[model samples]
Target chain A: MGLKKISDNTYEIFEEGMNVPARIFASKKILESVEKDRTIEQIKNVAKLPGILKYALALPDAHQGYGFPIGGVAAFDMDKGIISPGGVGYDINCSVRLLKTNLKKEDILKKQKEVVEELYRKIPSGVGRGSRLQITRKELNNILEGGAKYIVEKMKMGKTEDYLHMEEEGCMEDADSKKVSERAMNRGIGQLGTIGAGNHFLEVQYVDEIFDEKVAKSFGIKKGQVTIMIHCGSRGLGHQVASDYIQMMEKEYGFQNLPDRELINAPIKSRLGKDYYSAMCAAANFAFANKQIITHWVREELVRIFPKVKIDVVYDVCHNIAKFEEQIIDGKKRKICIHRKGATRAFGPGRKEIPEAYRKIGQPVIIPGSMGTASYLLVGTKKSEEISFGSTVHGAGRVASRSEALREIKGEDIKKEMNEEGIEVKAGSWKSLAEEAPEAYKDIDEVARVVDELGISKKVARLKPLVVIKG
Target chain B: MKFKFLEHTADVKFQAFGKNEEEVFENSADALKEAICDKKKIKAAEKKDITVEGGDYESLLYKFLEEIIYLLEAEDFLISKVKEIKIKNFRLKAVLSGDKASDYNFNNEVKAVTYNEMFVKKIKNEWVAQVVLDV
Candidate 1:
């Protein structure tokens, strides 16, 4: 457990016998915060996994985690490496999206309460609340495989550009419905478009400041402009997929043989690995489609309130996933499975993955802070490829657990405090509100500063939340 | 004596406390087993020897749990309990016993193990491990 400080903002946990060295990017303060938890050890465990290429890297928001630390990024050689369900997370494709509207702060303030209430009424929130799209198993399968593109093609809610703005263009080509278990399909059959509980939210925000005017303008973001942010992902279906795979891997993969059981992985070429990958991709697609449908609903609600208001998508990015992409490692292009858990893909400008419209400004990285704090809009830098494999922090990583937050502050009181600060908060349950209190998470500003200092990503704009709908 | 499923977004989470690391590991396994099926029906069959190696205690635990998960998936064996757990700085070897269920029966399927909200710490003199399995 000896860690060598590589730089002022970086540390390296060298690989021992049968281990790879783990590199962690963070400030001294962030490192100290992680040291208090079990994340450092977990990072070391990730290094021991089979076929782990390069280094197992942890971001600034690192904290204790199961197989990999939250905010962990690792790349594995596609030819020799394995894919683990633990790496992708249970909520497969849990992501965030930003939609810009024509309305300004003044216009939103005129009907803020009404707009917020309208959103709550239109979109279902809380645990187990299903949306209006109640499809059978057959339809659900299509949703799983189709993703946002399917929704766009079938539902005709948005254009092809909507999909283009998304990571992987909203649909992963390898998604195979047959790879998903019947039980997993059943769990997801009725849950599409629903906003589940615990940290999932839909917020109305205002662009208060623009740091990178060129990038902000490219994204159609302007000062005092109103925007909506959707934060959600594959629900029960993705969970069931993870659960089924974990159990299957546990029983099938011998513990004594592998470097780490929590990193229980199937060879990329193995049947189990292929099935899990296909199903995981399906779940990821389901998440994209779910968010797309929700976006349609959000648009409908806005139009109902502000008849002339126009809400257009800014960008959508997946935060939890294992994607295969070619990156120049050691000056040679190599395909690797980049597992970004509690992290985001920060591809530099002009990368093929970025939309053509944004080829000049780079991919927009949205880092949402706590409900009461200021969120940031950042653009990827070429420097990120060297430091983090083109990855960045996802959010204000949680510093306090739900129980701890509930014990420290009352939900009602927190709500009152937000109200006084000119923010509106709405949730189906108080416990949900308490679990997501601002104090429960790390200071996002500090996390952003570290990423900026490291040149992984550059801040583009700052956003202030006006209304929040939590489930 | 047993773990209860706490509501998580897409995973089955359990919080348990034990007097020692061995008990904590045993209890965490028990929690995971319970999460998969009815504990009363999951009887111990032939004993199985399992070993996991990691760079640290936490990784060792993760490897240990993954081993159990692999066994269940590959062999359809449902582990009932951990009989012994011996841990060093970065290596863990343990003995576990469980039966292969004729049919899979559980409330939820855990897809993978996540590093989200994962913990193994000491509270006073007792050891506590909390994990959020990706379901």
Candidate 2:
């Protein structure tokens, strides 16, 4: 791959087989770490997708993944484009939600232990934990189609403000349950409201520092204020949808000469592609509802542990999912299918798609840290249009494999270290906890800084964990 | 049956080896169950019929392992033993038996079977299957 440095935080990949060049938003250190993996080649392969427009860009947290690299972003012309299941990832609509509490860090520290325990009890975690809500098959179908709006409007789980803060208002339009497979539906049964294992978590943190005070204030975050973040996705339902469609697409459009079989895709206008879009939306909806239900449980637990703690949702955004978005391409606004594999849309201020309340300040970009690191809250910048297709880093991307982490780090030692640092932890399994050790991931602050330096996303506030619940 | 877990950044990966294709398929099914929970602790107290089809050796193995994941996720049915298995052309038939998820001690969760680095081939006259499961 021919590489050229466009700026201090931007690099362009001009390779032989690429349809378009790939731009990476990372500093030299971040680039060095990624070069140790196959993420660079994966980004180059993503550039070869049909009708891939602009640049197949990777964020600062980029890491090696199956077809498309994690933290990879690309846009394709609606008609000329193709939709790949690998582009959306196995965990459809895996996202992050940040909640703001009226209390300060001092208030949380006093009740951290009790609050963490209550939360673990209220919200089931771990493998195959049954739903707390007894939803019938009919209601479950509605949720599969309705998303977060179904939980809020129909089930009365949340208020209008709660729905407003979400990426798609908790429901994705054009979600056809018929497109969802029975096997996928079967996997979803009794699996709602769970924070499944492997890198998913619920963290209680405080705004430890403010970089952009004005933007932080606009987002209802302040230095020393308490906040909570939920990191998870659609669970088995989403994975099944991806698996089902990957097989379907491979059968329909045989991948005889693709870079990888995992990169199998269908033309966006094809029947199979349309069916996949519908099913993917359905799974994304489940993710929204999953977070909403957990929010309800968190609020209930918070009130019991610390009275008068008013928790308000700051923002919720999906990191893994593809959406048909209209973006300015070659001076004309065009609808393009934006595939954000392990990336998040960083639509800058004035984008009508974002919540009106924060449209002036730009969409809130939530980048979670590893198990015991500093997470960041940033806002999209207008310059993103010229960069990563208005997409940014998802989280502290992993550099170490789970097996390596399990062999090198012990769960008990991590737990003890976090305790010493005044952070509480509850995990489903020690092995899983070890796999999620902070050392397994890249430095999140350094990752976020690259995009911030590039002016794609500007840092607002930094958060340090007080309590972490890993499933 | 012989199986060894591999390394993946995002998911659980493993490879199963056997003397022949059927043995490899059965061993991979065992590998999938092992990914979910400790195989030694599970009991084969029940039985259910299983059948699947694929175009080739890779797809056949892919679908076979996928069936095991579907059983665990959808029906909450765990597989402790493979009572029988037969492969003819591109079709595979088998019987799996186990108890409900709630009845046993389970460890990790495997969301779905992914095609990343998935393949089945006879290398050195020994059938081997590799898979990376989304966990």
Strongest candidate by lDDT: 2
Report chain A TM-scores, every model: 0.97, 0.98
Candidate of highest TM-score: 2
Query: What's the lDDT of the predicted structure labeled candidate 2?
Result: 0.88
Residues A1-471 of candidate 2 have per-residue lDDT tens digits of 467999788899888788999888788888888888889888998988888998898889998888899998989888888998899998999999999999888988888888788888888888867788888878878998899889989999978799889898878997888888888888887789998888899999999999998989899889999999999999888988999999999898887778878889998889998999999999999999999999999998888877787988999999899999888887888889999998888989999988988999899999999998999999987788656778888998998888899899999999999999999999987887898999999998888787788888899999999999988
Candidate 1 lDDT by residue in tens digits, A114-162? 9889998888776435567867778777878889998998878677778
**Counted clashes in each candidate structure:** 31, 1
In terms of TM-score, how similar is model 1 to the real structure? 0.81
- Off-target runs (Cα >4 Å) in candidate 2 are B38-40
Say which docking band candidate 1 falls in: incorrect
Error of 2 at A462 (Å): 0.8
In Å, residue A298's CA in model 2 sits off its true spot by 0.8
Candidate 1's DockQ is 0.09
Q: For candidate 2 chain B, which ten residues in a row score worst on lDDT? A: B37-46
